[model samples]
Target: MMPSPGAAQPPSRGKARRGRPPAPISPGTGPSHRAWLEPVRSELFTSGLTLDDLVDRSGYSKTRISELLRGNGYYPAWELTFSVTRALGLPTPPLRRLWTAAAREAHKGPDWIRHCIEQVAHETEGPPLAYRAFCETLHQPYLQYARAFLLTDPRARGVVAETFDILWLSWNEAAASPDIRRYAWRLLRSRVMLRAARHQDGSPDLRAAVFSTDEAHAVQDPGHFMALTELIDLFEAITRLPDDQMDVAVLHYLCGFPDHQISHVLGLTPALTRAVDHHARATVETLLNAPNTQE
Candidate 1:
């Protein structure tokens, strides 16, 4: 029988080293691989499972399990990883998606990916097909939107990865919602916003400096001053728009997603997306065109 997730302590084994501690993950490891490895390690620590217990539960040798846990040697196929995760009582679907992402990062070929997946095909029924489809469909746009808000590639990838895991864990509830796209999009947005820097008024702090050419250019061209100021005001104005309008504007204008894509991302109809985009532009224009009382 599998050990309970809430087990107070891992069962004892006769005198033998539990397992060599997992080596520190290499700094050059890609973010996708690290994301999955981190959670597996956490589960190992909290469960108090030793190498012996894991070998018994997972039917793999201590050396192989050690390598898998340390993320050393060749990238593991899903079969071994699934066995370890199952023994540790981690949810299968989320870890599977995470493993898939890491595998792709490792440059594992499609045939190999399919083979690894097929090896685990009979492992429980797994999540619904729709859930898997959503993972594939939303990943890139989610990453782009996250980077636009968070302004760091690793941080953005981290947020997107976490969002997918959360969605995987809550797939049933999310799928049952009136609008799955909207539900998933909002969940992703919440994760991104949690890590984003905010203005004093609680708006997202999008840096206008990101648009600047260079210090020399700014000094050489007097018109650059006016353009920079207007850009800053425009970003601030975007931050103040209502949630739907702001999302549509950013996904459309900032991310360069077409109206149809923005509609798909935000779960709005194309017509509604266009309407929101129009309102966002009008609102921003009004904010920018307003006279300066301080001058």
Candidate 2:
């Protein structure tokens, strides 16, 4: 019979867990590994599920799960892996591929990648779908926003594919829960902001380039084209306003998210969202009427 979920397994007293010790990566490893693993680990740790929960649902032995995480054991045969994955409510194929890649790479050079794989393998002891889906849902809408953001700043293109990979993995893994999935969208937005801030000083021209008339016409509807132009102009004007006002304007006008959703996304009370919107509208009006500002 399987152990009950949440039951703690007694640790083998004074014995080192079997399997090879985790390999240490060299000092010169690139940023890619750290960048990749950090997000993955963050998602798992924040997922709210535990290792025993996964074992209960997946029917895999705790020892096997431990070995997989340690990077000391081969991936379970396909059927078993699939069953556990489904039980955890994760998207299957991408995770299987992730597991395969991690297992294969664990034995190769570049200790960073190996270490990351081992860490992910270990840390991701919970059921895959629940946490992964949670992370994916948090990021998908922002994926759409990222695509649009890229239209203005092509430099963002490099990270786009990697971002999608993370989203995909999260989606497949966490899709079973609505709350977790929705939170994924919020996380995606946060990531975009981080990326923008990182590149902000380096690319002043990006804003002007993205908002240009030629770029506006690419939307293909004469009405939309005109609206986009106006919107872009308004957004530029918004930048001159105080930061809080600018944030409110962007959330309401640019993203079109409902006031309540925006409130939740920004961690503000609904009353604050309304107040911010009102202040932003007043600020925009003041800016629009000021002499020498274009309509």
TM-score versus the correct structure, for each prediction: 0.57, 0.41
Identify the runs in model 2 with alpha carbons over 4 angstroms from their true place: 1-133, 152-190, 193-229, 240-247, 292-295
lDDT of 1 by residue, 1-295 (tens): 2323432133343445444456677666666676677767765655567777787777778888888887888898888887787776667778888888789889999899888888764445465688878878988899888887887779888888778886765665677789899999998898788778897768887664246324324554767667666566666777778889888877776677888888988888989988988999998888767795111
Instruction: Mark the regions of model 1 whose C-alpha exceeds 4 Å error after superposition.
Output: 1-128, 212-222, 292-295
- Residue-level lDDT of model 2, residues 1-295, one tens digit each, is 2223422332222343332322333343333333333333333334443456456655777676544333334433434444444444444445544444433434444454444334322323443464445334434334335544444435344344444455565553335455543445444544555455223333211244245434465677658757775665566566655645655555556556678866665556789779988988887887767785433
What global local distance difference test value does model 1 have? 0.75
The lDDT per prediction is 0.75, 0.48
Q: Which ten residues in a row have the lowest lDDT in candidate 1?
A: 1-10
Per-residue error for 27 in candidate 2, Å, reads 14
lDDT (C-alpha) at residue 22 in model 1: 64
